[model samples]
Target: MDDDENLPRKTNDPLAALVKQDLDPLSVDELDERISALKSEINRCEAKKSFAVSHRASAENLFKK
Candidate 1:
Protein backbone atom coordinates (compact mmCIF):
# COMPACT_ATOMS: atom_id res chain seq x y z
CA MET A 1 0.00 0.00 0.00
CA ASP A 2 1.16 3.55 -0.76
CA ASP A 3 1.90 5.95 2.13
CA ASP A 4 -0.51 8.45 0.51
CA GLU A 5 -3.36 6.08 1.43
CA ASN A 6 -2.73 6.81 5.10
CA LEU A 7 -3.35 10.54 4.59
CA PRO A 8 -6.76 12.11 4.87
CA ARG A 9 -8.41 13.17 1.59
CA LYS A 10 -9.50 16.75 1.00
CA THR A 11 -13.09 17.55 0.15
CA ASN A 12 -14.79 20.50 -1.55
CA ASP A 13 -15.34 22.08 1.83
CA PRO A 14 -16.62 25.66 2.05
CA LEU A 15 -14.52 26.39 5.13
CA ALA A 16 -11.37 25.36 3.28
CA ALA A 17 -12.28 27.61 0.37
CA LEU A 18 -13.01 30.48 2.72
CA VAL A 19 -9.58 30.15 4.33
CA LYS A 20 -7.92 30.18 0.93
CA GLN A 21 -9.77 33.28 -0.27
CA ASP A 22 -7.64 36.21 -1.44
CA LEU A 23 -7.96 38.92 1.18
CA ASP A 24 -5.48 41.39 -0.27
CA PRO A 25 -8.11 42.94 -2.52
CA LEU A 26 -10.48 43.64 0.34
CA SER A 27 -10.65 47.11 1.89
CA VAL A 28 -10.12 47.86 5.56
CA ASP A 29 -13.86 47.91 6.23
CA GLU A 30 -14.33 44.63 4.43
CA LEU A 31 -11.57 43.05 6.51
CA ASP A 32 -13.21 44.25 9.71
CA GLU A 33 -16.55 42.83 8.63
CA ARG A 34 -14.93 39.52 7.77
CA ILE A 35 -13.28 39.37 11.18
CA SER A 36 -16.59 40.09 12.91
CA ALA A 37 -18.36 37.34 10.94
CA LEU A 38 -15.60 34.82 11.68
CA LYS A 39 -15.72 35.70 15.40
CA SER A 40 -19.48 35.13 15.47
CA GLU A 41 -19.04 31.74 13.78
CA ILE A 42 -16.40 30.79 16.37
CA ASN A 43 -18.75 31.65 19.21
CA ARG A 44 -21.56 29.63 17.62
CA CYS A 45 -19.31 26.58 17.23
CA GLU A 46 -18.13 26.87 20.84
CA ALA A 47 -21.72 26.98 22.12
CA LYS A 48 -22.66 23.85 20.16
CA LYS A 49 -19.56 22.05 21.43
CA SER A 50 -20.34 23.01 25.04
CA PHE A 51 -23.89 21.71 24.72
CA ALA A 52 -22.73 18.42 23.18
CA VAL A 53 -20.18 17.87 25.97
CA SER A 54 -22.74 18.51 28.68
CA HIS A 55 -25.29 16.28 27.00
CA ARG A 56 -22.80 13.44 26.72
CA ALA A 57 -21.84 13.76 30.38
CA SER A 58 -25.49 13.67 31.38
CA ALA A 59 -26.06 10.54 29.35
CA GLU A 60 -23.05 8.83 30.90
CA ASN A 61 -24.20 9.75 34.40
CA LEU A 62 -27.67 8.38 33.75
CA PHE A 63 -26.29 5.13 32.36
CA LYS A 64 -24.07 4.69 35.42
CA LYS A 65 -27.03 4.87 37.80
Candidate 2:
Protein backbone atom coordinates (compact mmCIF):
# COMPACT_ATOMS: atom_id res chain seq x y z
CA MET A 1 0.00 0.00 0.00
CA ASP A 2 1.24 3.48 -0.84
CA ASP A 3 1.79 6.02 1.93
CA ASP A 4 -0.21 8.58 -0.06
CA GLU A 5 -3.28 6.34 0.03
CA ASN A 6 -3.55 6.85 3.78
CA LEU A 7 -3.80 10.61 3.43
CA PRO A 8 -7.22 12.25 3.03
CA ARG A 9 -8.14 13.43 -0.44
CA LYS A 10 -7.63 17.11 -1.11
CA THR A 11 -10.84 18.98 -1.76
CA ASN A 12 -11.49 20.59 -5.10
CA ASP A 13 -10.65 24.30 -5.22
CA PRO A 14 -13.49 26.82 -4.79
CA LEU A 15 -13.45 27.73 -8.46
CA ALA A 16 -13.42 24.10 -9.52
CA ALA A 17 -16.20 23.30 -7.12
CA LEU A 18 -18.19 26.26 -8.41
CA VAL A 19 -17.82 25.05 -11.95
CA LYS A 20 -18.98 21.56 -10.97
CA GLN A 21 -21.99 22.76 -8.99
CA ASP A 22 -25.57 22.19 -10.24
CA LEU A 23 -26.83 25.49 -11.63
CA ASP A 24 -30.27 23.97 -12.30
CA PRO A 25 -31.16 24.30 -8.61
CA LEU A 26 -30.48 28.04 -8.48
CA SER A 27 -33.07 30.72 -9.33
CA VAL A 28 -32.42 33.34 -12.03
CA ASP A 29 -31.66 36.02 -9.42
CA GLU A 30 -29.34 33.67 -7.54
CA LEU A 31 -27.51 32.83 -10.77
CA ASP A 32 -27.04 36.55 -11.45
CA GLU A 33 -25.68 37.05 -7.95
CA ARG A 34 -23.22 34.19 -8.43
CA ILE A 35 -22.08 35.62 -11.73
CA SER A 36 -21.39 38.99 -10.11
CA ALA A 37 -19.44 37.37 -7.31
CA LEU A 38 -17.41 35.32 -9.82
CA LYS A 39 -16.64 38.46 -11.82
CA SER A 40 -15.26 40.21 -8.74
CA GLU A 41 -13.14 37.19 -7.89
CA ILE A 42 -11.77 37.20 -11.44
CA ASN A 43 -10.86 40.89 -11.16
CA ARG A 44 -9.13 40.22 -7.85
CA CYS A 45 -7.13 37.39 -9.42
CA GLU A 46 -6.11 39.54 -12.39
CA ALA A 47 -4.86 42.30 -10.10
CA LYS A 48 -2.83 39.81 -8.10
CA LYS A 49 -1.35 38.37 -11.33
CA SER A 50 -0.41 41.87 -12.55
CA PHE A 51 1.28 42.68 -9.23
CA ALA A 52 3.22 39.41 -9.31
CA VAL A 53 4.41 40.01 -12.85
CA SER A 54 5.56 43.53 -11.98
CA HIS A 55 7.32 42.27 -8.87
CA ARG A 56 9.14 39.57 -10.84
CA ALA A 57 10.26 42.13 -13.42
CA SER A 58 11.62 44.36 -10.67
CA ALA A 59 13.52 41.47 -9.11
CA GLU A 60 15.01 40.55 -12.50
CA ASN A 61 16.16 44.14 -13.11
CA LEU A 62 17.81 44.31 -9.70
CA PHE A 63 19.73 41.08 -10.34
CA LYS A 64 20.89 42.22 -13.83
CA LYS A 65 22.76 45.27 -12.43
Candidate 3:
Protein backbone atom coordinates (compact mmCIF):
# COMPACT_ATOMS: atom_id res chain seq x y z
CA MET A 1 0.00 0.00 0.00
CA ASP A 2 1.55 3.33 -1.11
CA ASP A 3 1.01 6.39 1.09
CA ASP A 4 1.17 8.72 -1.96
CA GLU A 5 -1.98 7.20 -3.40
CA ASN A 6 -4.16 8.95 -0.80
CA LEU A 7 -3.16 12.48 -1.86
CA PRO A 8 -5.67 14.48 -3.90
CA ARG A 9 -4.61 15.54 -7.40
CA LYS A 10 -4.62 19.16 -8.57
CA THR A 11 -6.43 19.77 -11.87
CA ASN A 12 -7.33 23.48 -11.83
CA ASP A 13 -5.60 25.13 -14.81
CA PRO A 14 -6.90 28.66 -15.26
CA LEU A 15 -5.37 30.29 -18.39
CA ALA A 16 -3.32 32.87 -16.52
CA ALA A 17 -1.37 30.16 -14.69
CA LEU A 18 -0.58 28.42 -17.99
CA VAL A 19 2.05 31.01 -18.89
CA LYS A 20 4.33 29.59 -16.20
CA GLN A 21 4.25 26.03 -17.52
CA ASP A 22 7.47 24.45 -18.82
CA LEU A 23 7.35 24.46 -22.64
CA ASP A 24 10.81 23.10 -23.46
CA PRO A 25 9.56 19.54 -23.96
CA LEU A 26 6.52 20.27 -26.12
CA SER A 27 6.55 19.40 -29.86
CA VAL A 28 5.39 21.78 -32.61
CA ASP A 29 1.97 20.20 -32.75
CA GLU A 30 1.57 20.48 -28.99
CA LEU A 31 2.51 24.14 -29.11
CA ASP A 32 0.01 24.75 -31.90
CA GLU A 33 -2.68 23.02 -29.88
CA ARG A 34 -1.89 25.21 -26.87
CA ILE A 35 -2.13 28.31 -29.04
CA SER A 36 -5.49 27.23 -30.44
CA ALA A 37 -6.81 26.41 -26.99
CA LEU A 38 -5.63 29.74 -25.63
CA LYS A 39 -7.27 31.60 -28.50
CA SER A 40 -10.55 29.84 -27.87
CA GLU A 41 -10.31 30.68 -24.17
CA ILE A 42 -9.61 34.33 -24.98
CA ASN A 43 -12.68 34.52 -27.18
CA ARG A 44 -14.83 32.88 -24.51
CA CYS A 45 -13.62 35.36 -21.89
CA GLU A 46 -14.25 38.32 -24.20
CA ALA A 47 -17.80 37.17 -24.84
CA LYS A 48 -18.44 36.89 -21.10
CA LYS A 49 -16.97 40.34 -20.48
CA SER A 50 -19.19 41.88 -23.15
CA PHE A 51 -22.26 40.20 -21.71
CA ALA A 52 -21.42 41.42 -18.20
CA VAL A 53 -20.90 44.97 -19.45
CA SER A 54 -24.19 44.95 -21.28
CA HIS A 55 -26.01 43.54 -18.27
CA ARG A 56 -24.49 46.18 -16.00
CA ALA A 57 -25.50 48.95 -18.38
CA SER A 58 -29.07 47.62 -18.50
CA ALA A 59 -29.21 47.55 -14.70
CA GLU A 60 -27.92 51.10 -14.52
CA ASN A 61 -30.52 52.25 -17.06
CA LEU A 62 -33.29 50.64 -15.05
CA PHE A 63 -32.20 52.36 -11.84
CA LYS A 64 -31.94 55.74 -13.61
CA LYS A 65 -35.54 55.61 -14.80
Candidate 3 runs further than 4 Å off? 1-16
Model 1, 1-65: lDDT tens digits are: 99977876578868868988999999999999999999999999999999999999999999999
Q: What is the lDDT of residue 17 in candidate 1?
A: 85
Rank all candidate structures by their TM-score, best first, as comma-separated numbers: 1, 2, 3
Candidate 3 TM-score, true structure as reference: 0.74
Residue 45 lDDT, candidate 2, scale 0-100: 95
Candidate 2 lDDT, 1-65, residue by residue in tens? 99977876558656557767999999999999999998999999999999999999999999999
**Steric clashes per prediction:** 0, 0, 0
Spell out the clash pairs found in candidate 2. Answer: none
By lDDT, the better pick of 1 and 2 is 1
Clashing pairs in 3: none
Q: How many backbone clashes does candidate 3 have?
A: 0
* Model 3: per-residue Cα lDDT over 1-65, one tens digit each: 79966875456745436766899999999999999998999899999999999999999999999
Query: Where does model 2 exceed 4 Å of error?
Result: 1-10
Model with the higher TM-score, candidate 1 or 3: 1
